[model samples]
Structure formats: C-alpha cells, structure tokens
Target: MRPRLPSSPPAAGVTRRGLLIGGGAGVGLILAWALWPRHYLPNLTADTGETIFGAWIKIGDDGHVTVAVPQAEHGQGVYTALPQIVADELGADWRTIAVEPAPLNPLYANALGADELFETARDTVAGRWRDAHAVRIGMMVTAGSSSVRTFEDDLRQAGAAARVLLCKVAAARWQVDWQACDTRGGFVFHGKDRLRFADLAAEAVRGSLPDALPMRVNEDDTRLSGQSLPRLDAPAKVDGSANFAGDVRLPDMVFASIRQAPGGSSRLVRVDRAAADRIPGVLQVVTNDRWVAAIGNHWWAANRALDALAPRFETQGAIVTSATIRAALQGALDTPGRRLAAVGDVDATFKDARLITAEYQVGLAAHAAVETMTATARFADGRLELWLPTLAPAMARDAAAAAAGIATDRVVVHPMLVGGAFGANLDHRCAEQAAILAVTLKRPVQLTWSRVEDLLHDRFRPPAMARMAARLGPNGQILGWRARIAAPATGQEVAARLFAQDAGFRTALALTPSGDPYAIAGAVPPYRMPAYAVDHHPADIGVPTGHWRSGAHSYTAFFTECFLDELAHLAGTEPLSYRIGMLGGDARLARCLSTAASLGGWEGGIAGSGQGIACHSFRGSHIAVLVEAHVGEGQAVSVDRIVAAVDCGRQINPDLVRQQIEGGLLFGMAAATGGSTGFTRGLPDARGFGDLGLPRLADTPDITVELISSEADPGGVSELAVPPVAPAIANALQAATGYRLRCLPLVPGTK
Candidate 1:
C-alpha cells in the first residue's frame, strides 16, 4: 500500500547550501532556487514494532524487511527483480523481504524516466533544479524499461547504507572496528561474534554512513540476483486477490460512463438528457465541452444510459480516413526531411553508385491491453485522492489537480497493479476525467471506458512509410544506406504533453527545435557501415500517436532487417551470412546470429526452405531471431518453430528474461499479422479484441531461447524481442513465395 507522505517543502538551510541571513534579492533568490538544502523523510508506514531506515527500507522487530519499489508491476517481474537486488546486496534472507509501492517523494523519483521523456529538450522554465522540480511536480514515471538500469545503483546504495549502519552498531557492542564487520543471512558478524539485524535496528538508526558504500559482487548463482526466484506477486495474482485500479472502492461512490469527441477540432454537440433520464438507474447526466457522462449506482446502468442518449459530435479538419493517413505519410516522404543521424556523406556516396530503394508501410496499431481505461477518484474538503493505473504517478496527479482546479499538493495518487500496460499507462486522460466527474458530483466516482471507447480513443502507434535506399559495393557489401521515415514526432508529442505547463496541450513540434532523435530511435544500423543516414519526416496525420511496446524500434527494425534480406537476395548472398559479415566489432550480435542459426536448423532461407533470419540491437542489448514459417492456404502465416539468442548483459532473473522474450515474440507476431486498424470518419475501424487476431494457446509454436551469460551491467529485456519478429516473418514469406510483402499485418491490408 502507498501511504501519504509529507507534502510541504523543507525549511531553508544556509551553511554553504543557501543564503538565509542576509543577501541582495537577486542573489538570494538565485541561491534559494538552486542551492537550498532540503531533506525528505520516509513516509512508508511502519508497524508498531517496526522502524524506518532511510527512505527505501523498514525493519520490524520480527526481522521482516520491507522495501519500497517505485516502479509499477505490469506483468514484468520488477517487484521480484528489484527486491532480489536489494536482498543480494544487503546479505539478507530472501524470505524476510517484502515489497511496497513507493510513496511520492524526491528520494524515489525516477531520474532515468525523466531523461527519457525529455530526450533532447530541456530549454524550459523548469530547467533549473529540474530534478527536484520534476519530483515535486509528480514526475515519478515508470516507463522506458529503465526500472533496473536507472534505479539499481540507488537501491543498492540504500541497502548498503542500512547494512553498514547495522554493522556499525553491532561492532560497537563487540568492541571491534565497523570496517572489519560483514553482513550475511540477516546478521552482522565479526570474528565468530554475530548479531541479528532485528537486534541492531533499535540503535543502528543513529550510526553514520561511510564515505563510500561497499557493493556486493556476484560470484555464483547462490546469490539471489543471479538465481530465478519465485515471483513475490505471483501468489496474489494466482489466488485472484491482486488489486487493480478497477478494484478500488470508496464509500458513497457512483459509477460513470462517458463518450468524448471522436474527431479533430470538435466538442460534444448535444446529448439527449431526457432520454438518459428515462434509463432505469441513471441518477444524473454530466456534460462538458469535450465529453458527456452518465452516472448511476451500477456501471451497467450508466453504460446503458449512454447508449440511449446517443450523443452526437461534429468534426472538421478533413475527415481522417485510411486514405487520408496514407496520403499524409506519402506527402511527407516526398518532401525533404530533417536529418536526425548521419555518420558520413550519404549523398556523396549515393551519387557515385546506383541507388536501390524500397518503401515499406505500417498502419495504426493499438495497445489492446486487457484492462481498459479505469480510474477511481474522490474529492472532498479541497483534496482529491485518485486510484489510477498509470506509469507516471506525478503526471496523473498534476493532471487530475488541473482538471479539478485544485493545487497539486492537494492531490494524492495511488498507483495500482496494472492488468497490462505496454506503454498504454503513460497517458492520464482517464484520471483527469474521473477527477472532473468526482468534483461535478461531489462524491467519490469510478469512471471506466467501454472496450470500444478504449479502442477508438487509443493513441495509436503512428502509421508510417519508410523509404530505404542503399548502394551496394562491387563485392556484395553495403557501401551506403539511407532510411527516411515519415511518421508523427511521437516522442516530442508525448514529452510536450507530459511536461507542458497546461498538461492538456499535446503537441511538441515547436518545443523540440532539434529534430526528435527518439522518432528515429534504433534507426541507425549496428553493422559496420562506413556511411549511412537516417532522417525523420514529421507527418501530421491528425491522429494522436503515442509509444508502443518497443517504441520506434519495432517498425524501424522491420524496415531495416526486411530490406537487408531483400538486398541479400538481390546480391546472391545468404541472409545470415550477409548479416554476420557486417558485425564490425559487435561480437555479441554476431554470436547471437550464429547461435540462433545453428539452433533453429537454418537452411539458408533457400527457395521452398521456409527459413528466415533477422537481428537487431536495442537498449544496450543484442538479439537474433530465426524462424521456420511460410504462407499457408488463403495467404495465412504459419510459423512452425522459433529460436532466439540474446545477450542482455546480465540477467537479474533469467526466468523473467525468457518470459519477456516469449511474450514479445507473440506480441510482435500479432502486430505483424493482426494488430492494426484503419480510420474511417475519424473513428477506429476495429472495435474489440475479437476483431484483432491475437494469439491463443492452441496457436503456440515450438520455441527455444538461449540467454548468454555475461557479468556486465544489466540491459533492458522487456521490449527486446518485439522488434525482429515481424521482419523475420516477412523474410520467411519472401523466401517461400519469392514475393516481398511490404506493409504490416501481412494479410488483408497492404498500403
């Protein structure tokens, strides 16, 4: 449970940290803003006999250790993985460790996530003291697969500091120096003398920390981090006792069902209040400039009332159809684009050699999480409390505060276990709507979007058209390559909405003077290319675009790997060999390709062989995928087997790594074969999950995953396997049918 923390800022400290006694107004204000000293006290509630140690840990008299986790649990094993890190470092028994969702505090702010959101733009008014400023503003986001990579050091430091303090107290009692003490199995030891951590906790809080924290080195699998520990959250999930946002309940609560404007530059035209009033249980109707809602005691009544009311909306700005979306991308592709990345003079190399060009298309893809948009909110006594499923608790709190016209300090957000996030939890529109409804009704309110509403309002992965151009050397080697992608500046768009003062404004083109590198993330090849260029052509498709699971890497990998397969075929080179030859100094990716080929029984992707190969690098990790697949009757894709080899630096939990890879493979296949929709009159063409051909249990294939063991810093694994699945499938189809399919969803629609 996330308990309420201190809301006010700390008092002034004037030693060398700030000027408090006397100074000019200008100097004092600058010092106060930039150098003022502040301390954040731990607010994680402790039991009667428990004691708080720093901000991240608490210890009970029974030796139970509770650790605070800032990241949300969204199917990934963050709750287990992070605690494993702490347990390993603290030398504590794993059985004694428990997890809690961290409360809002600067000590728990996710700096890595903040950097990811503001990739290339910090030229804002909040640039000064951005770290402190962002934390106070509720920027504690949990996206970007950065939970371990960014927060590991801080978590380890917290554990180590506590361990040292405990040891210091124990050493004092034993008449020994603290530096000669060690911790293991929840005890502090020195020369055959030992003290349990629980016995030292009462006095350890007064001990000072050393200048440098001592870190634990993993020497064997016996260490908790290297082993595959049972998931801490699995028991609750299996017992059906896990609490999500929908499970939140409060006294005197009402349910709401809403319908918002469907298209661009429009608002709610009218609603039949009399018709809604006629519904059996609907108590009231609420209308705003952008949406209308029906409130009732039961959710069904509220939902039924909306159907009877039949609200109408008028849209302008050229009806956004599939044809219009494609045209916008094509127009942008035809125009000159800004260069986001360049290694050498691509134009000069292309001028001397004949250019081989291919353009690939991908339509709009939805997140399709099992749990739709849901939030529970209560507003009373000038304070609002929200139970929300969100990656950014701070952003949701701020947005809800704005929607309710209250101060941010007056709002508290309880981040709940997500049913499925995959980047969908980053948007907080539902939280804002719930806040508005709670304020309007003067009672606790729970708002849920119907499945259709979730699909129709999904900020889709942008529809993009990528033009890939390459010049081959005389000896079957790539001399120069260029990938010009036309898609919305989605990264900037998200950052704009996330960091904007209003929090309602959702455009970033003006804020990002430098072209968005995030739009073309993973566009640069990991191969040894002497010269290549990647450009971004920002297309205004009049449809809101947000991050998908793998972000731009999913589509960009498809474009690069599939086009490289085409080039290999044209040059009479084997697909796997052609890729392995361009490894440069990236021996890790080379080994992944070689291992996958050997294990998957690759047959060179020859005609009628039904074998394919694709590899990619993302988030400091390398992956290679080999699949046995072909087109069946009626052009349906059938994959018989898949083999993946990955080198993700280190595995905090090997089981979780394999789980992510397997889940990502199926997710990417769905995106490639069935996870897309077109727009007609500004509404999504597909309405529900049944329309999207998601994989079922019976459709499973033979799968093998090989995790290379390395002692390097951990890289991201959650989104690693998603990028190459589509390209490998497309490459397999090319080998079997001798026809290159360009667009996504390999069936039905091709742009």
Candidate 2:
C-alpha cells in the first residue's frame, strides 16, 4: 500500500532564488509571510475555494474546520492543544474541528523555540520578534517546548480574523450592519437569523477584509483555553490508527539496513558487495566512506543481508573508552573556562568567607525514543520527496536536496507522526541517507535503523561535570557562589556539521565571546546570590553529543540544586525553607516551592523518614518537586511518594500539562537511577533498554501534581518538570543515608 501525501498546496516560490526567478510584487507577499504579516486577511484557501484562516486553519464548504498543526506531534497533545486555541477564539464548535500536520512552510517556523536558545533575543520583546522572523525564514524546527507558546497568539488572531470576515459577509447578505452580527458555534447570527460558517465561507473569501481585528477576550463562561479538552489525536493513537514513520509504506518501496563503522571515527575499508547481492530478496548494496547498507524488498531480508555481508572498517586510532572520556572531563575542570555569567566580586568575597565545595558528574544518556530512526524517500522528475519524523523539517529538506543534487525548492518533506523525539530527531541523517539511496537506485527507499544501530549511533546527551564553591555569610546566607562546568557544546557541534563547507567561517564564529547557550543553560542558580560566577569549559570527547530533553538544564539543575541542599545541611536549615529564603522577590519560584512543600506534607522532619525538595524555572515555567524516599537494605533507594507543583502561566490544557509533568519526572527518574550510556572500545556499550537500566512500572513512585492557575500568557511545560526530579530524588537519598551522592545513576555502592 502506498502512503498518501498531504493535500496542502506546494509553498509558493518563497526562497531567495525563487524570488529572483519569479519577479514582481508576488515575491513580496511570499516574503511577507516569512518576515511579518502586514494584513490580517486570510491569505490561504482550500481546494474547494473555501477560505483558510491564515496558514494554520482552513474552513470547508461542509462546515468542517481543519487546523494545520505546525509542530510535530510526539504524544505531547500538541495536535489537539494548538487547534483548541483557534477554536476557542473563533467561537467554533469543537466537534467540527479536525487537526492535520502542516506542510513544510516558512509560515509555520518555530520562532519561540529559537528564542529560548538565544539569550539576547529572549530577553527583549523587539529582539524576540525579530528573531522569530529570522527563524521563520531559515530554521523551521520543533523543540524547546515552544509549540503552543510560540503559535498561540498567531493562531488566535487567525481565528479572530476569519470570524470577522464571516460576520461581515453574513451582514451583507442579511442587509444588516456587521456590528449587529455575532458569531457562536461556527455560525454567524443576526437578530433573528443564523447561518453556518460553511454557508458563508465562499462569500467571506470575496468580502471586504480587515487589516487587523481584535481577538475576543477569554471569559470564564465561554473559555476553552484552560479547560481539559479531550486530546483530538488520542482516539487514533489508542486504536492504532496513528501513522508513524514505521507505519508508512509505499508501493514498490524497498527497505534498507545500515551498519556504520564500530569506532566513532573509523573509515569503512570495503564490503563484499557480491555476497550481499547474492542474498535472497536483496536488491542492492550501498556503501559510503563510513557505512555500508543493504537494500531488499523486506526489512528482515535487508537486515539479514547486511549482517551476512559483515562489512569491515579500518580503525582510526587507539580506542577511546568511558574511563578516558571521564578523565578528560575531569582534566577540563582544572583549566580556566570561559565565563558565562558573572555578578559582583566572587574572588574577593570567597577569599575570607566560610566556603562549601562539591563536585558533581552525570554520564551520557540516550533519547531512547520508542521508535527508532526511520525515513522513506522517493526521487522522481528531478525532485525528492521524503516522509520521516523530524524536529527540523526545513533542515531535513535542505539536506536531502543537497544529497540528491537538487534544488532546495525541489525537495518536499512530509513530517510523519513522531513516536517520540526527546531532542533526538533534530538531526536528519536518516532522511539524508534514504534520499541518497532513493536517488541512486531511482526507486523509493525506506530506511529503518535497527534498535542496536539506533542506540550505537545515537547523538547521546553529553556527559558533564560541574564543580561548585559557595561562600556563606555569618547569617547562613549565600554570600558568593562559583560554578565551573565541563561538557561538549551541542551548539558548536551542530554548527560545525551544518556549515562544514566553510571552516574559516565556523572558526571565526566559534571564537566569538558568545557562549554555547545549551552547555550553560541553567548553570547559574535562579536564587538571589550576592556574588556569583558561572564558567563552562567545552570539551569534545570522542562520543557524539546533542541536545537531550531540557538540554543542559537536565544536568545543571541536578548539580546546582543538590549543592544547594548540601549548603542548607551545612547551615542546619530545612531544605525547603532555605530555598524559600534565597528566593526573595521571585514570587513564582517561591510559590511553587511552598506549594510543593505543602502538598508533600513538609513539616521540617518526617520521623524516621527522609524528605527532599527542589525547584527550578526553565523556558518560562516554574516547577518544584518534593521526594520522600527510604533507603532499604543493600542501599537500595525506594521513593515512597513524589509531589510536584507547576505554574506554566495560562495552561492550554491542564490535563496535558499534568501529563507532561508526570512524563518528565519519569524520564528524569530513569536517568537518576541507572540510565548511563557507557562506552567500551570507543563505541556505545548500551544496546537496548536493559543495558541502559530504564525504570520500570514497579520503580515508579506515588505521584501527585498541583497546577497553579494564572492569567498570564502560556509558558512551556514539556521539559520544565524534568530538571527538578533528579535533584529531589538524589537529595532524598542523601537524607535517608548520611552519604552525599555527587554523580548520576545513584546505584548501590555508588557515593
């Protein structure tokens, strides 16, 4: 069975080269969508000639409302939440609303997600808007938990504009003033007459449109934004109707299996192509400088052929082991690092003040998404088309085009439903590989990486080490704080790969004073400190590293929060109370910390028990977690209960927010327990979940979550709850037993 392509129209000639080729004001309109909207009119229309409410929404003659979700749906309920924003503002019937993945277009780029990565842009409103437009033109990606936060306003405005146009059309038809018309339940109504949106959609497209329209203020009576609407994608997913990349099958499509060099940088010497071709059902053998792949009619046959071929590679040098990588990281900590954040005079204050010091380390971890990397590519008529799960569709399209020797405009990307990403899908190597094979063979090729292949080649989360030294005052306040971290810079690695052609340009850019935003994220404590300095030493160990969920915050929060707990213990103060004291003016952090404490029944001490609390703010969300655990015999730590409080300002869906928080906690707990991706002979040793020591259902704790309601704009919630869980659990274990655990994977016999 062949997979069907989406019905969305091809994007107009919007690229720089396209603009030059198609000269006129039409190019300006295309550029405007990439830059900023100057008019409020719905610019897109459906095949039925019905009006489309901006790039995200479409109205049909049959009264169905379809929302094009720009972000990839990876079980986060984004497909449902994004449309809810539009339907709520448009006064449309929720039952009539359907969601579809938006096409690869500049209009759907993730501006908010990019803003989170750049500090200067995130700090100012004008800068954020400017960067948003820049991201729209160049980087169309889905990460940083910005799906809702970035597109909320635009989606609302789109719905509001459509409603305004519909009302005007209805008013003209009824010979009444537009102001006398009202919209409700996908209908435009006069004093005594009402018409469905389908009846007026055609007229609305031809009617006079407004340059701008105000969105209806959400009232308590008719508001749906904060309400717990059922996930629109839930039924399909539950019934196994959801289409992931693995589920995508095309007619006459061949399957491919790849085997890369064992060592990180080894070179593929050669492969017995004749032997692989002799295998039953094997169609072809593709070999590159570093990898060999086998293609066949079925995945099993392709995999079998690849294994039978047993391609060999030439070793680059001495194998790099886990011990060597750890030693290098530790050595990096001794060097003077580039300062990320500095406030007040830390050196002078730390010279005479009472000081406390601790060093923390975290090992490499994998995204380990449910579905491995997979992509299907087809080349025909000098164009390349791909179906895959990708966080960055634009980058994938560009890479595929480059690999296929075609223009970027000739490449089409169909983003399939992601089984799960956790920041791993940002790289499009699988798509590129499939595209190359498809172009080479002149037939459709579907490449699916085996579990072992996926794990071994995964861009694992960078292992990091941090050393913290704090100066305490006579009153037990933090007088000065200094933190130095050593880790591979995700930004540097990604930039170098993306711009591999211009080494001089990359070097010049790397030499700039700007820090690796991801490496230093959440490195500085959020609490009020008189003198603080945070530094980062970028160390590129042999292992490949990329962004994991929450990026540096995943490990930095654990480092800083555990150290803070140690300081509190040193000061003989309660952990929760000490955090609250440092958080003076930040009411949000304080509220979350206090709320979690209250929910977890924090009353100084639980007789014969251990309780720990941790709080952090990331990507605009504030979250706090409390863990109650007991260290059983053999030093095994069992968490009895965990409580969390979150304030992600103006929740889109309370249920989804809670789900994200719970999921994030589980993810963090797995990493904290025994999720290290160790290396042997310069290769990843973890082959599957068992080797990674993933947490099971029996290991889960009794979890409770409390959402703090607010009227502010929506904030990111996807990764906000992850950073606090590890620290809280580690602190609880430390409290249960009088030994401080400074490294991750707090297993038995580890200190």
Candidate 3:
C-alpha cells in the first residue's frame, strides 16, 4: 500500500484544521501537562536507614538517595560536573551518592540555554552571567556553559528544602514544636529524641515546597562560591560499562552502511544492484538524492554490499579545489566590498600614522569525533522513532515528525550518550536519512556513515580570509584599525544574524571602531588612539559553513591578537605588558590576562621565546590564554607551554572545566595545524583521515596548564578554549622567528 500522504493545506500556508493548528496545539498541551513550573528540580529522599553529613546522604529502608541531572553528556562532562554541586551544598559524602539522567522536565531549561535567550543583545560571558537565574523555561539541555549556572539555584534550593522538610516531618511525628526539632547529620532531633532522615523521608514527601531552608557555608563562603569539586561521573566511566550512543542495539534490528556521491554536487545517475542484491543477508537497496544505502543482517555485510554497489555521478563543473579557495581568500583580502563594522575616521587614522597590513588564510577543518555519524529509526503505523546522539534534538524531532506525516507527539526522540560531538551533531543528516529509509520500507533501519563519506561530505568550519591593518600613534597607543573578512556565503548569513542581534546594542553603545568583540580590540582601544575606527567587509564564496568549536571568534581572535602583537613589537614593549597596559579600564580583560600570564611564568627575557596572549569573553565566561613556543629550524613550531585561565563563576565540578578546556584546545589545534576538508571544482578533494589531517596523539604538545576562576561569573567553557589557541600560537611563532606566518597550517616546512 502506498504510504498515506499528508493532505495539502487549504489556505496556502495553512494546513487542515486538525492537522495544522489543532495538531500543534495538541502537542503543546501535552508538553504543558507533562511538565510543571518547579518541575526542573525534583526532591530526592533517603529510605528508612541512614544519612551522611546531611549531604549525598541516604538512610534507606535500603539506604540510598540518588541525585538526578538531565544535562546531555556529549563528552563535555556535564553529567559528572552538576552532581558535584548537590554534594558540595549538602555537605554530603560524595562517594556514596549515585546520579541518574533526570526525566525531561520544564525545570531543565533554566541554565545555559536560558542564558542564550537572555543574551540576545550580545554573546558574552558577562552577558550570560548577569542573567543566569532570572530566566525560566526548564528543559534540560547541554549547550553553552549553563549546566552549573542553571542548576545553581534550583539544586541548592532542593537540598535546603529537603533538609527543612525532613525536620518538619520529624517534628510532626514526634509531636514537638518545629523549633524544638534541630537537625544534625541527616537526622532531626528534639531533647533526648532523634529520627533519621531515612525514617522521616516518606512523611517529608507529603509536605509542600519549603520556603525557608538553611545554607551550607565554608570557613569563607566566598571560597566555595567557585570551588572545584571532583567529577561525579568519573568513577562510573572508569569502571568500564558507560553506555554511548553507538553501543545501543535493539532486538531484530539490522545494520546498514550508506554511500553518498563523492562530489557534493553530483546526483545518483544510476545504480547497478544485481551483485549487491545477491549478497546472502542483504535485505534491500535504498537510493535517495545523493545517498545509496545497502541493508543487511549485519554491519559487515552491509558494508561489503555498499562497497560492491556501482553507482555513477555527473560532475557539475571543474572541481572547485582547495587551491581555488585559498586563492579566493587571498583575493578577497585585496579588495573588500562590504563593510560590517565602522567607527571614527578609519581612512584618516590609517593614512596619518605608521601602520602594518597583512592577509591571513585559513583552511577547512573537521569535527573528527571517534564515533562516526550513526542512528537507528523504527518507522511503523505512520509514526517515527529516532535514537541517536545529537546536540540539537528539538530541531531533529521537528524534521522527523514533518517527514513522517505524523503528530510531532507521535515522534519520540531519545537522546543517547555521544562519544564525541564537537559541534558536528548540530546537524542531523544521519538521523533524518535513517528515518526516511525505515519509513519507506516499513522496517527498523540503522544507518552509519563511512569515515570516507564523513570526511568528504562533512560540513566544515568555514575557511576564512582575514586582512588586518592597524595605525599606531607615537605614544604607543593604537589610532586606527581595519579588517576585511570573507568566507563561504553561509558564513555571511551567520555573521549577519549575529551582527543583527548586536545591532541595537551597537547603536546604543556607539562603541568605537567595532561593536562586536575582536573589533577594535573589543572596542576598548588597546592603545589610546584618537580618531579611531573599525570596519568589516564581507566577502562571499560557495563553501557551506556553520559553527565549529569556537565559531567565528576562532578566526577573528587569531587575526586580532596576531596583529596586536605586531603593533606591540613596533612599540618596543613586551607583548604581555603591552596588552595588560592596553586593558586600562576593562577589569575582566585585565584579570584574565594577568592570571594567564602568571600561570605561564611570564618573567620576560628569552630573546627568541616571546609570550603571546589573547583574551575573550563568551557565553558568560572570560578566558585568556598565554603561549610560549620555540619556533626553531625546519619551520616546525613546537609549543613549549600553554596556560589557560577562565573566570566562570561558581564551578559545580572543577575537573569538568579542566577537561573542557583541554578538549577545546585540542579541537582548535586540529584546525590551526593540519585539519582540512578540501574540495576541487565543487567536488570534495579530501576523502578520509589520510586526506583530512587531524591532530594525533604524537602531535600533542609537551605541557598544558589550566587555571579556572569559579570566583567570577560562570560562562561557557566548551568553545572559549578554542578561540584563543590559534592566535596565541601564531603570536608566539611570530615572536620567536620574527617572521609572521600569514596563513593557517603555517605549511609544515615553508616559513
């Protein structure tokens, strides 16, 4: 039977009464009914036996209370970090407490994602920090650096409220006045009377939300404000049975391997399925726009059949090679057509003062997470079910629902643990494809993208071309700045959206030079320059683009910091001291710079080893990086040391913060050095690991030092670690060799 087609809308844009408005309303109502206002934080209780220092405590009929968190664990350690908050506040034994992924609740939305909505006017650590608690919409998600900040209030309140409720329950059962019942070590007490929290838990659940709850404080309350605690998930992860998305398997499910056109522009002109069909367990051959799938009883059989299937594609034009993109980027630097930022008399400043200008070219990069893109979808009875690891599942849910012609409520999205995300899962092609095939055949299907296709067709971090020019006064202050950046057309759109979001604030602040960060030294005028201005000229290309680990900030910081270092050298001052002095009024910038410098042992002097630093504030966290590298013979740049410091106020788990920083650095390093997804004549040129180079264990640096300041406002740590790495490394290389490399990858041996 032909699949039932969704009826077309009657009023052009409007669909059938029940299918459009009513269907959406029904879904919304269901969502509302399933969630409650204070639903974000659920109360955990001990049974009938024991309790700890009142924290992580559980006196159970069996003796246990387990904390629950809903944050997605995509290798960022949110699962491990958030529980630390509960343990710290409860003065509980951290070891005895176990944590489970919380059910979907409205309360989960209060953190980082909420802050993103509040940060509409600007994207910065300060912005997120200032509005962390005011917003509400509890849906647990892991994005930005909100896991700790979002749960800070709710979790603390839950623990404190639980304590109050336990005392109330104990006092009522003992027939004593509430005041007479004092609580200590998870037990309620009246003179010569005591009842453990485990015994009182059942009664406590009958009480309402506690209004007044006691708080835990350290010898110095401020010290614990941003204290680092051990990661909660580390023990389980070390014990060997942690479940990742790839580990999931359903009964009677079959495996599939898919192949797509090597050239993105090519379409399937033909498919010779005779040989593939003869394979023992090969179930079917499914072909779509650019994808051809081979389904079999096992993954190996599918893979073998996929390899045997002969398909041909017609090329659109000459392959738009990497050399072409490189050349185009260089050309864009020569003549900028569109300006995104402008302030003061930029032309006058450049013409009047001593200046330097250079063009930097960056290559494509990949999110080569060890786990390839994979998904399982079961389509039956006009309903679709998806099980995959994704960073943006809401969008996926909508897409899957629309495709299946079913109520979104009928679509169930189960988020699984990811081995790695690195911003790649932001798009859900694999899940969509898997669902489409399953729906077409009315059977469950699991599709996996081969590493070759992943590399060849992967959406890459937009390649960028940046032109930097600066004018300095005789007093060692910067007078003017000009930057022209061009990337794929999609980047311009992303930039436009980001720029538009800041338009109102930019107009209100009338920030000098540039309104956005990294524009005119984040508009702080690093070196007191009069008649200052900053401008951006948008250039366009054909490559598809989206956010990488650090997004645009990564490339922007490299250009801004490297140029600033050059300006410092011309002024005859140490780069560290020069930047520090430039940050005259920005205390946040100054603090991070100072801290990072201190961590890197910035004492000056190694004639060839120069210190390079860059500071940025994103998603409510201010981070600064310092790099010390020896750029010796062979043009082989070896970073001897790297120091990263972040002030992301109130750390729930210090170890996770450190790990995120490490991951961000490694991710950024891959982009800076060897990572590339090159194409030719609009066809992918790079095909696999060998073609698309990534940082290997052997390529890792000697040492990396991380220092986090939870004392300050908490902002996101995931991507902040990346933006500064490239610039820091570039600045150090320039300091050491006295020859600034103006392109990415610095080309192994060519400087």
Best by lDDT: 1
Candidate lDDT scores, in order, read 0.83, 0.80, 0.62
In candidate 2, what are the lDDT values of residues 48-146, reduced to their tens digit?
745676677788888999998878888788988999999988888888899877765556667567546433344443444445344434455678888
Best by the TM-score measure: 1
Worst 10 residues of 1 by lDDT: 503-512
lDDT of 1 at 518: 69
Reference-based lDDT, residue 14, model 3: 37
Residue runs of model 3 more than 4 Å from their true location after superposition? 1-63, 90-92, 102-106, 110-119, 122-141, 174-197, 210-229, 262-265, 315-319, 327-348, 351-354, 489-539, 603-607, 631-635, 704-710, 748-751
TM-score of 2: 0.91
- How does model 1 score by TM-score? 0.92
Candidate 2 segments whose C-alpha is farther than 4 A from its true place: 1-45, 48-50, 118-133, 136-138, 218-220, 274-278, 498-512, 605-608
lDDT of 3: 0.62
* Each prediction's number of clashing residue pairs: 1, 0, 39
RMSD of each: 4.0, 5.5, 8.2
Residue pairs with backbone overlap in model 2: none
Please give the lDDT score at residue 556 for candidate 3.
Answer: 69
Model 1 residue 74 CA deviation in Å: 0.9
